[model samples]
Target: MTASWKNINKPSSPTTAVTAAQVANGPVIPPQQRLLTYSPDEWEGFVEEWAYYCLPAKYKYVQRFSGAGDMGIDIAGFADDKRLKGVWDNYQCKHYDHALRPGDVWVEFGKVIWYSYSGEYAAPRHYYFVAPRGAGTSLSRLLANAAKLREELIANWDKHVKDEITGTQAVPLDATLRAYVDAFDFSIFDAKTALQLVDDHRATPVHTARFGGGLPARPASEKPPQEVAATESRYVTQLLGAYGEHTGSIVTHPSALSVPKLKDHFRRQREAFYEAESLRVFARDSVPPGTFESLLDDIHGGVIDTHDANHADGYEKVCAVTKAARDMQITANALITCTNPKDRDGICHQLANEDRLRWTRS
Candidate 1:
């Protein structure tokens, strides 16, 4: 998730250009309906997003395989260090004009069983057939009843699985292979309906951009902890140095500030820093990558001149820079809408933490 919330929180469906028939009928195709028109590569890309982004916490790693000799592994999600040899799952991407049927995937079943039996890789814990049109009614029933699915596959082995496993040679179901097939678990095979895929995809950062749905609501920002966190050390030290410069003494801590007003300001600054930190975490879970960094760049560009201006003390410089940041016109970034004035202030401190901004001419 990135800092920017540009595409999120908008309408779930954007209005597309209407055709003559649609104008006359006053009907618009829904976003998911557009999947049927997608090319093979586009469909695979959608599945890839669903697998990798939507299930990050579930799978240790997700990889997409292409070209020949892949052994029917379109996408594999590893659960542990053992990778394919250990617990894993597979997502098979299929983009056809119609819904997937039993006839469409018997060979795929054979490939998985044969390859795993040959020690090429362990059989997946779960195998999902993901298609644009989803699985047909007949196939859906077979998948639901695992025994029926296995029976059909074994019965249709010669016609669909034997000659279809590879072009170079036919993989005959001999006595040993037949025994292996009988013991294999067909319960792991299933299908994800198109609607389910779309629903799950909503959790990913790319969903809004790909489907035109607005982002989910932003989570509430967390309050700062009572103790100063170690991550705040650099910026806090700089602020204390600025305060020291103003008072002509070493201001070691916030409690050391004699002026009540300065103490309040210090506390407020700490709160603002935590606010920005919360926003950074929000961006990580909600938006695309680099959103928060880009917002920082915008704030840095807006406040640099004011920071460089002459001031009687470093405190004045800090105040002026943060104020300028707050007042800065940020019409370009999508994150501007969700940001508060204090977030702009906190972002300055964040920049300082990275040595990108400074106070007291240091």
Candidate 2:
């Protein structure tokens, strides 16, 4: 049966021919061009998108708020599906480019606890600290400690001891205290699980965000001010400064052989250079008719070859293919010509292997 299936799946012959009817249907979409644009806003948008996607269809009509700054809460809304009665969840999104610190964990957890207690709706039956990136070790430890304290409080209560309430028991934290700590193996609650809880809860189709008090929507004109752009710029500058310092040290101490670090740096540089050159080639080749010729002439006449000599073998091949693609007027960076017949056959086989790729234009 497998042999028959393989025979049936054999690649078709490759021929580059376009009919007027095929052209009229539409120009082929390039893979890179077809890729969805990922803006900074969209980066955090995934938390909401995934939350909504994982949610049961009944819960789909819930109101969604992104970047909601109720202390640490990034998202707040209710899932109004009949199956999940009074189902709602608040999210504390940590868009961290770096590892989360203990302070972040304390702050967010504190917010969840605070909102649960003081907010008009009183307490959400289900609660979560939805950190998309995950929490740091220190933060995880803090959560563990909070969980331990909750356990101790419950244990003491069971034993008919004094009703001394830990800070967590005051309001919001009291309601979610049990689940947050008991649901996970605290020993293993790394940044990954901190983020995974949001999805896991959704998979079970649980709704946690419950509000008793009516909360008015802040108008678009009255939305809270965000300093994200300034913050991002500052972070970038700091990162660039750190990179410059490391690069300076590396240049001064060439004998300091950190093979892995050096290799990673070169690998990233190669990838970036390849992408930039590919984009340049793509833009040059995509110009309307006569303009491409002038662009090509300018590119060919340029001194870019001096840097090409320093490139690795794979990168050299990529450069060669890019130039060939530009000359051939191929608009895709993903399409590469194979010199060896065996390699070409392999490429065809791979392309044919996937059902989705069957209609893809090479």
Candidate 1 residue pairs in clash (backbone atoms < 3 Å): 1-283, 1-284, 2-287, 3-292, 8-215, 9-214, 9-215, 10-214
Clashes per candidate, residues 3 or more apart or on different chains: 8, 7
- The TM-scores of all predictions, comma-separated, are 0.84, 0.31
Which regions of candidate 1 are displaced past 4 Å?
A: 1-31
Residue-level lDDT tens digits of model 1 in 1-362: 57777856876664677666455645555557978888988887788778888888889999888878889998888999898999999999899999998899999999999999889999999999999899999999999998888899999999989998877898999999999999999999998877888888877766656764445787777777777789998999999899888889899877789988778888889889888998898777766788778999999999988988998898899999999998989975657768898898899999989888887755
lDDT of 2 by residue, 183-245 (tens): 433332223443354434333211111111111221121211222233123322322332334
Scored against the true structure, residue 183 in model 1 reaches a CA lDDT of: 95
Output the lDDT of residue 3, model 1: 72
The C-alpha local distance difference test score for the whole of candidate 1 amounts to: 0.86
